[model samples]
Structures are given as C-alpha cells and as structure tokens.
Target: MEPIRAAIVGTGNIARIHADSLRGLGDGVRLVGAVDVDVDRLSAFCDRYDVPARHPDLTSLLEKEQPDLVHICTPPGTHHDLALACLEAGSNVLVEKPPALSLAEFDNLIEAERKHGAALATVFQHRFGTGAIRLRAMLDSGVLGRPLLAICHTTWFRNQAYFDVEWRGRWDTEGGGPTMGHGIHQMDLLCAILGDWTEVSAVARQQARRMDTEDLSMAHVSFAGGAAASVVNSMLSIREESYLRFDFERATVELTHLYGYGDDDWRITPAPEFADEVMGAWHSGASGVRSAHRAQFAEVLRSLRTGTPAPVTSTESRRTMQLVAGVYASAFTRSAVRPDELSTDSPFYRKMEGNGPRW
Candidate 1:
C-alpha cells in the first residue's frame, strides 16, 4: 500500500510531537514536508525529524508538496484558517485540541470539509487510551448501568512566566485560559463517557494570571443521559492533577493522572451485587495502551485507509466545543446556557467571551 504523504505546519513544541507520532507510524505514513514562518525553528525541526522538504508557508507547501494529510499544530487562533485551507487543498486534517476559537469558526471548518470532501479530525488523544476505551466499552455493554454523576477537574500550575509567551493567554489568540486550553481535554473525555451534555452553568475568573482570559473556570453540566458533572479548570494550583470520576448505578470508576494514564491510574469500585461481573469486564477489556498522540494517529491512519470518518470528527468535536462555549456563555451572561442557546446569532458562538466578560 502506498504510504500516506503527510506534512506538518508550524514547527513548534506540539508540532514536534505530531511529527514524532507520524514517524512512529512507520510505513503507514510518510513525512513529506514541513512549514513554519520561523526559519530557524523550522530548520531545526526538519533536521531533527529528517524531513526532506521545508516550505515557507502553508500556501507554498500545499501547492508544491500536495501532501495527503496536514497536521495543524499552530496556535488556537490559527487552527480554523489552516484547517480550512488544508481541506480546500484536498487533504485530510488532524488539528490539535480546542479545534477552533469559537463555534462559528468551527462550523466554517465543518462546511469546508463538506465542500472539499476531506476528513477533518481534532487531536483529542485522551479518548484513545486503553483505560478510556475499556471504560467506554463496559459502559456500552450495560455492565456499569446508567451513569449518574461525574467530576472532571484539570488543576495545573502555570507560573506568570509561562504566560510570557506572546500568545499564551488571550481571547483573540489562545482563546480562553484554562477552561478552553487546559481543561478541554478532560472535558472532552468527560463528554466521551457521559454522552451529550444538555445544559451548563459556569463562572470564569481571572484570579492570578494577568491576561484577558480567565485563569480559572468552574461549571456544572447536565448531560442528556441524565448524568451531572462538576468541572473545574484552573491554572493556579501549586499541585497539579487531572482527575475524572464517574458514578454509575453498578460501579464507580475514577482516573487520576497528570498528563497520561496507564492501567494503574484507573480504579473501579462496584456495588456489592455487581462487583464480580464489573471487575471481570474491566480487567479483560482493553489493556496496556497509554493515552498519547501515537494511539490516536494509529486509529486516524486506519480510518483513512478504510475511507471512513476519522475519530474526533468535526461533529464529535462540536459537542466538546459546545460545552466550552456553554461555559463561557453561562459565565458571562450569568445564567445557565443550553446547547440550543449557542446558535450562530449568539455572541458566544462568535467568540468565547460572550458580549465581553464581566471581569
């Protein structure tokens, strides 16, 4: 089989991880070219990965190399335009998380995907881990019964120096702060397990960081499956942890880890009557895989080969993004926000800070 020709745009930190993940795929994919405005960073990244061609920008890269897939590893503000361009150029796209700055921009990218007939996927790698997969499988099999409650918290520390980077914490650039940036991963995984979220009431505060976006956001979400989740995203914690807990009728499953998870990071406690069956299912299901870019890339490559929609499709990503928009909307407007409330006409749909944040 001919390898999928791949290219990386924006040769920065996350781009390096994307290149490494693609390289790890071996014969399934090939790194054909790379592009970045910074010549020094681009050159260094190309040399490290042994990438053969380096282009000055996305236009020239698309016109010249014509790669089969393009990875958008740029900042949050740049994702919508880059992904749209890649789709228009007849290439599949794997974009990093918080796919776009707002629901409007994300919808535009979805439209481009339909008009151009290319797959558009977001890099929500947390969903690809075996622990997540096993939990999902068990839930689907009815062993866990109905989900009741969940707690998704991403409390990590980022000193003032961390936001010193130009695009670190701004509404126009990085979108919102921890809620949109750091917590979206756990929130996405939360949505993955609980299914559709129906309503959300949230509050965002600048707190410590002196940026336009909030340093912390706390929300209460109601899912369509009758599950309620309390989500907290903060960049002010001295001790960091990414924790998620789900309470179901039969069992309670919890994942505690900073960045990624192994089997040991997950714990399951079942109700007395269903303990044996729940434990058996959890033990025998998916195992050994850690949540990382490589696991997701493997599935993306397989979907490409099979000509099916890729994982974390724009449709799937919209749910998570909607929850994000809901948070900001509820926070800014001082009321509970429903999924239907975030229409194209809504301010939150256009920008994460609806009608400008109060604080």
Candidate 2:
C-alpha cells in the first residue's frame, strides 16, 4: 500500500508530535511539506523532522505540494478559515481540537467540507488510546452495566508565563479557559464513553490567574441515560491529579492519569460483585502521548484508502464544541443549558465577540 502524503501547518510544540509520528511510522506516512508563518521556526522544524518541502503559508502549500491531507495544528482561532481553504483546494484536513471559536464557525467549516466533498477530521486522538479502548469495551460488554454517575477532574497548573504567548490567554484566540483548553480531551472522552449529555450547569472564575477567561470551572452534566456527571477544570491548582470515574449500576470503573490524556498509566477498580468480570477483561492498557496520536494517523490513512469514515468525524467534534459552548453559556446564565439549545442565535455561539483571556 502507498503511504498517505501529509502536510502539517503550525510548527508549535504539538506539531512536533505530529511530525515525529510521521517520521517514526517509517513507512505508513510521507512527510510531504510543512507550513508556518515563522520562517526561522518553520525552517528549523523541517530540518529537525527531515521534511524536505516547506511553504510560507497555507495558500502556497496547497498550490505547491498539494498533499493528500493537511493537518491544521495552528491555534484554535485559525481553524475555520484554514480548514475551509484546504477543503476548497480539494484536500482533506485533520484539524486540532476545539475545532473553532464558535459553533457557527464550525458549521461554516462543515458546509465547506461537504460542498467540496473533502474529508474533514478533528484530532481527538485520545479516543484511540489503550485505556480508552478498554473502558469502551467494558461499557459495551455490559460489565459495568448502565452508568449511574461519572466525574472528570482535569486539574493542571499553568503559570502566567505559560500564557505569555500573544494568543495564549485570549478568548478570541485560544477560545476559553481551562475547561475548553485543558479539560476538553477528558470531556470529549467522557462524552465518547458515556454517550451524549442532555444538559449542563456550570460556574467559572478567573481566580488565581490574570487571564480574562475563567481559570477554574465546575460543571454538572446529565447524560442521555440519566447518568449525571460533574466536571472540574482548572489551571489554578497547586497540584494536578487528573481522573475520570464512572459509577455503573453493576460496577464502578475509574481511570486516572497523572498529567492528562493519552497517559497509559491507569487504574480500574471494579465493584466487588463484578470483580471477576473486570479481571477477566483486564488488558495492559499501556500508552503514551505518541501512541494515541499515531493510532489516529493510521486510521486517517485507512479512511483515505477505503473511503471509510475517520473514527472522530467533524459532527462528533461539533458535539464536543457544543459542550464547550454549553459550559460558557451555563456559566454566563447561572443556570443549566441543554447542549443542543446553544444554536446559531445563542450568545455563546457568536464568534469574534468574546474578549480573549489575558496573562
């Protein structure tokens, strides 16, 4: 099979991971080209990754290499236009998460993708991790039974220096606070595992940070199956202990990672009655950041070749974005908001209006 050709935009920290995945995969992928606004940094990234081709911007990159797919690793704010441009140019796109600043912008991107008949995927690669896989299997096999409750705690410290980047702390650029930024992966996985959420009520604050956006937030969500959940997201905590727990009628399943998503280091404690089943289902759910990212890349290749859909599609990503908007809406209204109630006319869905967070 021919290796899929890929070009990556944005040479920031995360892009290096994508580039390295392409490099380490050895034969499954081809690092065709790269694009970034910073010439020096772009050059350095290409040299480091051994990618021979580079473009100054998306336009030239599309016109030049015309890669089969473009990975939009740029900031969240840049996703809408970049994804549209690539799709219009007849290229598939795999954009990093928090797909767009607003739900409307995401709709625009989706429309463009459909009109152009292009493949569009969002990078929620944490869904492909070994731990995630095992958890999903348990949920599917009824070993955990119907979940009664769940909790996702994503607490990581981010100092002022971390948001020193011009676009880092702003709502117009980076989108939202810890909830949308740091906690999104776990939130996405929560929704992925437990099914859709019906309503959300949240409270947020800028406590302990100079950023204009909320550095801390707590949201209570109700899933379709009447399973309730609480998600606590923060960048103000002194110590970070990330965890996701699901309480099922038959058993309780818990997954914890020290830093965040894609961490294989996990622990699942089943209820005493279901202990045997849990033990029988146990597999080494070992993984690292690289492994999850690589699995998604390979899936992208399979989708391109077989015309099969990517595991994480744009619509699924939009639902995750809707959850993000719901968090903001719930915070602003001081009440619970249905996830689907945040439509095009909702205040939270208005793009380019919210002030970006400040350091």
Candidate 3:
C-alpha cells in the first residue's frame, strides 16, 4: 500500500509528539510537509523531522502538498477553522483534544466532515491504550458485570506561569479551564467505558488561579446505563494524579497514574464469589500497550487505509464535548443539565463559559 501522505500544522510541543508518532510509523505513513506561521519554529521542526516540504501557513501547505491526512496541533480556538479548511482541502484531520472551542464549532466541523466526505477525528489518546481497550472489552462481554459507579479525576498542577502563554486561560482561546483542557481526556475515557451520560450537576470555581476560566470544576454525571460518575477537573492540586475507579457488580477496577498509564497502573478487586472468574478474564485480556500518541496514530492510519471512520470520530467526540458543556452549563446555571437541554439555542452550546462564567 502507498504511504498515507501526512502533514503537521502548529509546531508547538504537542506537534512534536504528533510528528514523532508519525515518524515512528515507518513506511506506513510519510511526513510530506509541515506548516506554522512562525518561520523559525516551522524550519526547526521540519529540520528535526526531515520533512520534505514546509509552508508559511496551512493554506499554502494544503494547496501545494495536498496531504491525505492533516494533524492539527493548533490552539483550541483555531481548531474549527483549520479543520474545516483541511477537510475542504480533501484531507482527513486528526485534531488535538478539546477538538473545538465550543459545541457549535464542533458541530460545524461535523457538518464539514459530512459535506466534504472526509473523516475528522479528535486526539483522545487515552482510549487507545491496551488497558483501556481490555477493560472496555471485559465490560462489554459481561465479565465485569454492570457498572454501578465511577470516579474520574484529573488533578494536575499548572502554575500561574503556565497561563502566561496568552492563550492558556481565556475562554475564547483555550476554552474552559481544567474541565475543557485538562480533564476532557479522562472524561472522554469515562464516556468510552460507560456510554452515554443522561444528566450532569456541577460547580466551577476560579479558586486560586488568576485566569479568566475556572481553575477547578466538579460534576456528578448520571449515565443511561444506570451508572453514576463523580468527575473532578482541577489545576490547583499540589500533588497531581489522574485517577479513575469503576465499581462493577463483580469487581472494582482502578487506574492510578499521572499523565498516562500502562498495564501495571490497572488494578481489579473482584467480589469474593466472582474473584476466580474475574481474575481469569483479567489475566487473559489485552496487555503491554501504554496510552500514547503512537498507539492512536497507528489506529488512525489503519482506519484511513481501510476507508473506515477513524478512532474518536467527530460524532463520538461531540458526545464527550457535550459532557464538558454539560458540566459548565450545570455549574453556571445552578441546575442539572440534561443531554437534550444543550442545543444550538443553549448558551453553553456556543461557548463553554455560557454567557460569561458566573464565578
């Protein structure tokens, strides 16, 4: 098979990870081009990755190289426009998380994808890990029994200097604080495991950070499958941890890690009566792969080659983004927000702050 022609936009920290993952794919993919408005960063990234072509901007790159896949590593606010442009250019897009600044923007991207007949995927790399994959399989197969409760926590410390980057804390740019930017990964993973959420009641606080968005947000989400989850997204914690726990009828599964997790990070404690069965299934399940960009990129490339929708498709991403919006809406309005409540007319649908954060 011919290599998928791929290019990277936005030569920042995350872009390097994308470039490295693409390069690691060996012959299955080709880094044909790269683009960034900053000439120096673009040149340096291209030099480091041995990219054959470099453009001053995305439009020039798309017009010239016509890559089959475009990795969007730009800021949250720019994702909508860049992704639409890439899809219009007949390229599949793999946008970094918080796929768009708002639910409306995400829906617009969804429309663009359908209109262009090209795939649009978001970078929710957490779902690609073997551990997550195995856990999901077990749940689906009834080995884990019914999920009754879950705790999704993404607590990481980002100093005030971290928000000094101009786009880090604003609603119009970075979107919401930890809820939209930091915790969306865990939240997406939670959705992947538990399925659709029905309602959310949340509270957001500016707390310690001197930023426009909240430094911390907490929500209680009810799922359609009779499962409930407590989610906490915070940037003010001193000792950071990304922790998730799911209590099932047969077992209690827990994952404790900071940024990412491997097989070792997972732990299962089955009920005494079902311990043997749960252990047997857990021991025989998928293992070895860790959560990272490379795992997700491999799947993305495979989907592209097979003419299938890629992982974390826009539709799936919209669900996760909707949960994020739900948290914000519930917090700001001081009421429980349901899935049906957030349409184009909803304030949270357009901007995460929802008519400016009350906090």
lDDT of candidate 2 over 1-359, digit per residue (tens): 88888999999999998887777677867888999999999999999988889899899999989888899998887988999999999899998887788888888888998899888898887788767777788778877788899999898888998877788767889888788778888888888888888999988887877766788889999999879999999997778877888888766667777543554466667778878877677653334443267778878888888988766888788888888888878887777899666776677877422222222
lDDT of 3 by residue, 262-343 (tens): 9999999999999999999899998888999999999999999889899988889999999999999999999999999999
lDDT of 2: 0.81
Q: Give Cα distance to truth, residue 58, candidate 1, Å.
A: 0.6
Residue 32 error, candidate 2, Å: 0.8
Clashing pairs in 3: none
lDDT of each: 0.94, 0.81, 0.94
Badly placed stretches (over 4 Å) of model 2 are: 259-264, 284-291, 352-359
Model 2, position 346, has a per-residue lDDT of 74
lDDT of 1 by residue, 1-359 (tens): 99999999999999988988888889889999999999999999999999999999999999999998899999888999999999999999999988999999999999999999999999999999999999999999999999999999999999999998899898999888999999999999999999999999999998998888999999999999999999999999999999999999999999999988888999999999999999999989999889999999999999999999999899999999999999999999999999999998899999999789997
Model 1: lDDT equals 0.94
lDDT for model 3 comes to 0.94
